[model samples]
Target: MPPGITTLAADAPTLSAANTGFMLICSALVMLMTPALAFFYGGMVRVKSTLNMLMMSFISLGIVTILWVLYGFSLTFGTDAGSVIGWSQDFLGLSGIGVNELWDGTTIPVYVFAVFQLMFAVLTPALISGALADRVKFTSWALFITLWVTVVYFPVAHWVWGSGGWLAELGVIDFAGGTAVHINAGAAALGVIVVIGKRVGFKKDPMRPHSLPLVMLGAALLWFGWFGFNAGSWLGNDDGVGAVMFVNTQVATAAAMLAWLGYEKLRHGSFTTLGAASGAVAGLVAITPAGGAVSPLGAIAVGAVAGVVCAMAVGLKYKLGYDDSLDVVGVHLVGGVIGSLLVGFFATGGVQSDAKGLFYGGGLDQLGKQAVGVFAVLAYSLVVSAVLALLVDRTLGMRVDEDDEISGIDQVEHAETAYDFSGAGGGAAPRATASAPGTPAAPTNKKVDA
Candidate 1:
């Protein structure tokens, strides 16, 4: 080695190793969102299905995690031909993905990117399960998720985020899967709700959540993990990663929280904790797409509007009779659209790398592009998700038998209860069945702290 040559940078091995470590950590952070999601969905349901609801997120951790490593990543991020889907050039195995490989000139192991993106792929569909809770068969759900991921999720992920996809080619700027994750999942939830129909006692019964604090706990965890989810989209420790994502996340979330609470007080005459938690999530969803492309103030504007709009949207389901159990359509889908479109008008200097927003004197070209991108994604997701739901219904069947649904799926499906206070009762009090034709019993007063 010549003295002036500086050892030629160790053949890219050192840099690749460092970036791989950072990505691996980011993957772990994203994985935390599943359990966080468990609490979020779990707390929204009645007590009978608390454990069952939480298990939905947990099952994705088991199922999607393994599947992604096998062929999911290949189908998604593999080399593309014409941007429809990736070729099987790396199929059935992660062949040719080595430490020296580079994605966009960064010296990171391609496998690291594969795994981190896999975490996102795993959690996206799980977010929709909340909308069809307490009714559908678990077996049918597992089948639906499997097919949905393969057909709807993988192809759309490729179109939006993978290399050379049409959306990417069209200059659509989705910093962290606003269309791929949220809009796709939200739309899918609507499709499933249509197929499965409503819960037995949906509108007539109170159906209030058994635990509010649990919901708040889940929201907090999601808030914590989202920092990694949004910022980590940079795919490396880049110059703007910290500044752009950090302030965008905080400011938007804060504004949404305030907006939601304010609207609730005005409309409902009371500010419920549930509203606060939901508002925070609404803000988070709105900020996701624009996090890396909008100024801090722009993020706040986007989030505030999202919080108000989504809060109102929650009522639309009731008025329309769709039975979106957990408001996935209201929050994620609506919020996603708001964020994806607003960024085109709010993007500023250095955020978009050769693009500016309407406020910054960039004109309506960017906003038009953003609208085109949003509509394309929304239409594609709706058609694909509808097909997936129908397939699940026709083949294995999508919903449970009436008796099973009436009996509460926790015992019939998973063979477990979310709570067992009978042991403490000294065999004195009789255990209540979940579907006793009355309101489901709340769990024992013993509460888990948020």
Candidate 2:
């Protein structure tokens, strides 16, 4: 155990087999979300940039995992230095932690808890990649994730979740990470997009996804992994709060999917698969911060509102002239705000009786607190992320050149492609003759037996 840390007394049951197992499983589930997100964002961009899109998320797992174990955990969860940030060096590399030492309020090992939160650290910045897709330099993005996580994500996480952090002391109610994760990443995306500028053809090109099936598959994985993301946040199975959160997550996602489809039919005259997947994600984001506090009915309200509002919000990029290629700003920023704020109004004294919402007779007090947390994170993340992106842009460069953007970021940055259409997958598509890079393919007119 660390010098000042406390744990369950040795006389009492020190470890619960069930809770440890549950947390381990939950950690694994959250780990899968990064790759799941890679697929989710991967299938949304044009095929030329798909591999690069996947890499943007995949690289976070490598970068942030190292940083987290080194000092990230210490800065976010260590003893408070000034009520704004945790001890920056105490838990470096998680040193001085014992395998049997238990985390407070639970029987699980501290290692289990540390790794679980590490997964959140990994996924948060990857969430921003979708907005800047098709245009960023992979090296610059990697560097930005390093600096941003250190400066922005780590300190904000401390403020929201650490014991003496101001937000935790101020009655903020982020059961999960409406403030730290979603809102942080979403607002950061907007900041970077301002500097990254538009893709080659902001609204002029028909940049339809190359594969809807891939998008659907990725969404399915995200839905599966989110159970652990939202529910396992409780850190123990003994509390019934996890169960309520689980059910709320499901219902809210289902409601959001339907709401999005309905909005599409009313506005565009057709229901689309993309709408269904995006709506489900919108619902997932909406319930993440509120699920532990709201009743099932409240969840339905939140999901429906997010589905409709986010469906409308995605169009803002076009009208406002900022290009968010994958709608991260709309889905995450808008959905996160909806979830965080609605908790102020929909909280039903579910988790804590004193945390009732306005309709529950708690009045507008909680609503105002929620607004403070939401906008505080929004403003801080937006400003810091923009400064980081701009600094990286000036020093190391940020966006790829126009030619690379047009041809394909996959080959330009990563030296690979997502698909090889030259009959590589047991198909009979003709292989092009070696010639100039942009030459048209020769057609075959030879007769062949059926």
Candidate 3:
């Protein structure tokens, strides 16, 4: 080989393969979250639609992955375009983008970062599906996710993470995904539940989950992978990445867990396993935005407060008569807003160069900024989500046929059972087979009166 050629190769801004490896691992770690989400959400629903709930999160693995590779990444993190959306410079393909080439100034490969973020994009919308569980049509849901992602998820992601996004330009500190992932998912969930209507017997039915163990497993995976989700935002293991975010993650989650259990005991008279899992998730959501900003003490406060607030918020479904079946709006949206606003009051000295909170003596200026960020995200998400819901309802339709829903999405939509007590061939006892082998049974085309 020519010496000149070797010199050129060395000089090229190629990311060291080692760095690429780390990022790919991180990406994989992040991707694991979607399935974990399936388990988390699947275990929360009634046994009838359990498989449908799990599939809701699982389908994202297939759908969003394709979208991200095609154009989702470009629309989100492409070059600086406008406060509204990104340009198509990254169109058709990831052309000119090299594995190992850094994004902005980060040490990891841009591809690695893109794929990792892809997992988050896949999971965020899946989170909303839980709100309308057991009642939505499988085909309608497939169509809805496709359309919703193109309109709502993509634009919101661009605004928060993309350079040209308005929120990014405003210096709002969303360290992880307070506004983008949690708030966006939460608001969309609320819109979906309202539009789809409630479950058949929402208030009166004993809708407890069938599998607490699965819920525990899902929550554990989520808590574990969250380190990558949040810490990996740094894009590399460089600097004090291990110390700062790690401590914040641990402390906040623990505090939130205790706070949630404590509240459950105080109010409901029993500290249930469900509350434990929910509390952990609440802490994770609360700390997502604030973890990189607040101190350990701040994280503790944030987590504890989030646990109590979300616990209270979960009951709103009963009060308002909106069936947010899985508490997506309650835990994620409410928790996200709490953390986002609290950071304005608790943000002292952490990773990003943001203002201090009220406790840190920064006063109302930062708090107001936090409020602006929260309300802007909430209002935008709600309006756009509602509009998108209306579009899907009109175009591809939204809710499932009433009979299909009453019979259960797992039996009607997927044609597969969540469990096989009979241990028949190929798993569960063979029920009536439907279209698409191994696919869940879908609803028959008989429409119910809207």
Top model number, lDDT: 2
Candidate 2 regions with alpha-carbon error over 4 angstroms: 1-13, 88-90, 423-450
The Cα error of candidate 2 at residue 106, in Å, is 1.4
Tens digit of per-residue lDDT, candidate 1, span 1-450: 446765345454345565567677778888888899889989999887787788877888778877777788888887887897876655446675655666655656677777788889888988998998888767778878888888888888898888888888887878888899999889888877877789887789877888999999999998888887888788777576545886798889989989999999999899999999999999999998888888888988998999999999999988999999899999999999999998788888577466787888889877887888788878877777777778878988877777877777788778898888877857555565666567667667656699
C-alpha lDDT score of every prediction, in listed order: 0.83, 0.92, 0.82
TM-score of candidate 1 on Cα atoms, chains taken together: 0.90
The TM-score measured for candidate 3 stands at 0.89
Error of 1 at 143 (Å): 1.0
Could you give me the TM-score of model 2 versus the true structure? Answer: 0.92
Question: Which residue segments of model 3 deviate by more than 4 Å?
Answer: 1-19, 424-450
Q: Write the per-residue lDDT of candidate 2 for residues 151-229, one digit (tens) a residue.
A: 9999999999887898888888887788899999999999999988999987889988888888999999999999999
RMSD per model, one decimal: 9.1, 7.1, 11.1
Highest TM-score among the candidates is held by which one?
Answer: 2
Query: What's the TM-score of each model vs. the native?
Result: 0.90, 0.92, 0.89
lDDT (10s digit) by residue, model 3, range 168-268: 77777788889989998898888777677888888997999989999999999999888878777766666675457778988999898899999999999
